[model samples]
Target: MTAPASSAPPLPDPAPYQGAPERHPRRPRHPLDTATDPEAVELTAPVFGPADVDALDADLTRQHSGEPLGERLTVTGRVLDRAGRPVRGQLVEIWQANASGRYAHRRDRNPAPLDPHFTGVGRCLTDGDGRYAFTTVKPGAYPLPGAGAWRPAHIHFSFFGTALTQRLVTQMYFPGDPLLPYDPVLAAVPDPAARRRLIAAYDHQLSLAGGALGYRWDVVLGGPAATWAEEGRR
Candidate 1:
C-alpha cells in the first residue's frame, strides 16, 4: 500500500482579530480590511501552489553582494497550527530596515544612512519541521514625522496560508523594547497579551559565537494563540 494519508484536519479558519474602536483616530482601520470588506464565501484560490515556493524562499541574507552594517542577527522560528503541529511549506516573507533603521525605499524621508549591501528583504519556506530562519542586521529605532513619535525597531512579516482567507500580515518586535508600549501603531492592538505575542524572544543558544545574536519566534495561525496576529499592523 502507498504511505498512509495524513489524518489531521485542515487548519481552522482563524478567528477575526477584533480591535477596539477607540484606535480609529490614532490608527484607523483600512477601508478594505477583512472586517468590513466582503468577498465570495468560497475559499479564494491560492496564487501559487506549494511547489512554486522553493528553498530560496527561506534564505534572505544573501540577496546582496556585501555584508550589511550594524549588529548581525540570526532570526529563527517555526510556523505551527493551534495544536502546535508544524505547518511545513508555508510561504513566509520578511522585510525590514537596515541597521540604521532606514528603509531603502525612495519614500523614506529618514536621514539615517543606508547600507548598500542590504536590500532588507528575504523570503524562505518552512522546512519539514515547520522551521524558518534568516540573517540580518539589528535595525535601529526611527523617529516618525510627529513630535516625540519614534517607531521601535521591528521587522515586517507576511505569511500566506493555503488559501487567500488564510493569509495574515503582522510585525515582529525585539524584546526589552521600551518603545513598544508607547507606539500608537502597536497600541492599536487591543489585547495586551496579544501584543506581547508579537515580540520575539532572545535565544542565546541560537546565537552565533562572537557574532550575530539569535531570536526565536513561533507563529500560530489558528487556535488559542490566534490572537497573536494582532490588527493595526500592516
Candidate 2:
C-alpha cells in the first residue's frame, strides 16, 4: 500500500491587534495631561517618527569607541507622535544580533561574541513624558538572505500602540552605511528623500563625551498624529 502525504493546514492571516478595552484598559485621562502631570506619571508607547532617525544617530555617534564592538548593543528611543508630543504609558521591545551578527537564540550559530549581560533584548516603560532608555551595544552588520551579502547594522523595535490595537514594527539604520544603497529593505521606501529618514543623524548631545557611539532614536508611531490622536480620542 502506498502511503499518503499529509497536507499542512493553511496559515491564518495575522490580524491587526486593534487594542480594544477588553484587552487594554481605557486611559484614565488624556496621555498628554497624564505625562505632564507630576503626580500622574505614565509610560509612553513606542512610536517611530521622522525625527527619531536623527536623534538615534546623534546618540550613537557621540559614544563611539575604539573598543571592539561587542555582542551586546543598547537600543534606545523615545515614543512620540507626529506633533512631537510624548505618549506615556507604553512598552518598547528591541531585538538584535551581536556585534558578530550572531543571535542568542538556539537557531543562530555564527559564533559572534555574545555579552552574557546583554541578551539583545531590552524593554523599558516610558516615563511620564514618553521617554525610554535601553542599555545595549552596537550590533554588527550581518549577512542577509540575498546573494550571501551582509546588511548594515540595525536594530528592530516594536511598539504597544498605547491604546487600541496600534502596534508597529520597525528598524533603525546606522549612519554612513555603504550597504544602505544596495539594501533591499531600505530601498523599499521608493523615495530617496523618504528613505533617508530611516538613517540616523549625528547629534553631539547623544555623545558620551569620551565614547565611540551611543544611539538616541526617538520614533513616532502610526499615521500623522491627527489620525492616531482621533483613535486616542475614541
Candidate 3:
C-alpha cells in the first residue's frame, strides 16, 4: 500500500537549527523565527506531480570518455512517509562538488580542480517502490573561507514532495567521514539520530564489483523523525 501522508509537521527547519549566534551566514535571531512563518504555514503549495526523469540524468559516471575523479558511487534510497509506506513518484535532485572539492559553477572559487566531464548534477524520480538511485563520483573535502574551515564530502539533495511542507532540501554525507563531528553545516542539525540520517551507510551488497561502490540512504517525510530540511519561512 502507498504510504499515507502525515498531518504532522516536518523536522525543524535547518536555518533555525544551525542558527547559532556566531554562525557566519548569521541565522536571524528574531523572535518571529521561532514560529512558522504565516506565509509558509498558509500558502497553497503547488505539486509538480509525477515526472519522467531520464535514467541518463541519474548517472554522473562516464559523462565523458575518461572516468570522473574520485571513487565511483551508487547512492540508492527509498522515499517513505511517516506511516512507513513507500512514497512513489517523488522527485529527487542532487548536486555535488567534484572529487577535488570544486563545483562546476563559476561562483565557486575553490582551488580544487574541476573535472571536464563531471557535470556534478543529476535528477531522477522514485519508482512504484519509492526507490531512487544516483550514479556519481564521491565529492571531496575542501577548505572554506574561515580559518581552518573545511566541509566534508557530501551531496546536496532537494526533494520535491507532494506539498509545500513536504518539500525538503538537505545534504547527504558519506559514512565514517571523520569530519562529520566538526563540519559546521552538519553540526547545525540538533538531533543526533537525525544527523545520522544524513549519512549514507556503506552497502556492499549493492556494490557492482569492479565498478561503483554502493550506499543506501532512506528518506522519511513528515514523520516524527523526518529528515532535516531547509527553512521555507524565508
Candidate 4:
C-alpha cells in the first residue's frame, strides 16, 4: 500500500508564493552619463581676474632672488577642445620636481637636492589662441621609494575650465626620456599613441636664442585624441 504521506509538514507553501519577487529592469547606461563619474562632478566657479596672478607667476625660474640650477626650458602649448577650438581664458597650471628631481614638499624623501630659486610651480591664463607658456628647468629623474623604478623628467599640468570641477590634469614628459618605458605611471596608459601624446615635442622656434630650450605640447580636452589624464581615462 502507498505509504501514508511522510510526517514532514508540507513545505510551508513557499510562504504564499511571492510571485517572482518583483524584477525591475536595469536602466540602460547612457554613453555620456557623468552621474557617477568623478571627473564630471560640478564645482563652484571662483571669480578670477588679471590681478589674481602676478605677471611673474608664469616664470618659475625667477620666482626667487637668484636663478635656479639645471637646464632652463621653455614649455609652451595650446589648450584645445575635441573640436580643435581654443579654450581661451582658461587657467593652466604646472608644478614639477626641481632640476634635482626633488619636490618642495616635506614628504618627498628622494634624497635629491632642492632648488631654492625654483619653486616648480607656475600658472597662466590661456590666451585667445589657447596658448600657455612656462619657463622652468628640466626636472631630473628620481627613483620610486619601493618600486625599483625611476620617474622620467616630466611636468605636471592642470587645466581649469569655467568651474574648478572642470579641471583636467596631465603630465608633459620630455621627448626622449629613457625612463618613460619603466615608469609605472606612464606605463599605466595602455595605448602607445596615447602615451606619446604625453611627451612634449621639441620646438626650436620657441627656444630662446641664448636661454631656455623649447618644448611644445598641445592639450586636447576631450576626444579620440584627448590627452591622457592622470586621474582617469577620457
Whose lDDT is greatest here?
Answer: 4
Model 1 scores a TM of 0.74
Listed in order, each prediction's TM-score against the native is 0.74, 0.59, 0.76, 0.79
Backbone-clash count (model 1): 3
Task: Point out the higher-scoring one by TM-score: 3 or 4.
Answer: 4
- Which of candidates 1 and 2 reaches a greater TM-score? 1
lDDT of each: 0.74, 0.56, 0.79, 0.80
TM-score of 2: 0.59
Which 10 consecutive residues of model 1 have the lowest summed lDDT?
10-19
Candidate 3 regions exceeding 4 Å error are 1-52, 163-166, 208-210
Candidate 4, which segments miss by more than 4 Å at Cα? 1-43, 208-210, 232-234
Error of 1 at 6 (Å): 49
In the range 87-190, model 2's lDDT, one tens digit per residue, is 88666666777667777788665656654544566555676789876555677877664335566788776666644346666677877776665555555444
**True-vs-predicted CA distance for residue 172, candidate 1, Å:** 0.8
lDDT (tens digit, per residue) of candidate 3 on 1-234: 999985544443444433343423446543333255665533455545445557687898856677787888999999898898998888888999998999999988898788988989998889999999999989999886654657889999988765554567888999878676667777667777888888999988789552679999998887787877755521
Q: Where is the poorest 10-residue window by lDDT in model 2?
A: 225-234
Q: Report residue 90 deviation for candidate 2 (angstroms).
A: 1.5
Sort the candidates on TM-score, descending order.
4, 3, 1, 2
The best candidate by TM-score is 4
The all-Cα superposition gives candidate 2 an RMSD in Å to the true structure of: 13.8
What's the lDDT for candidate 3? 0.79
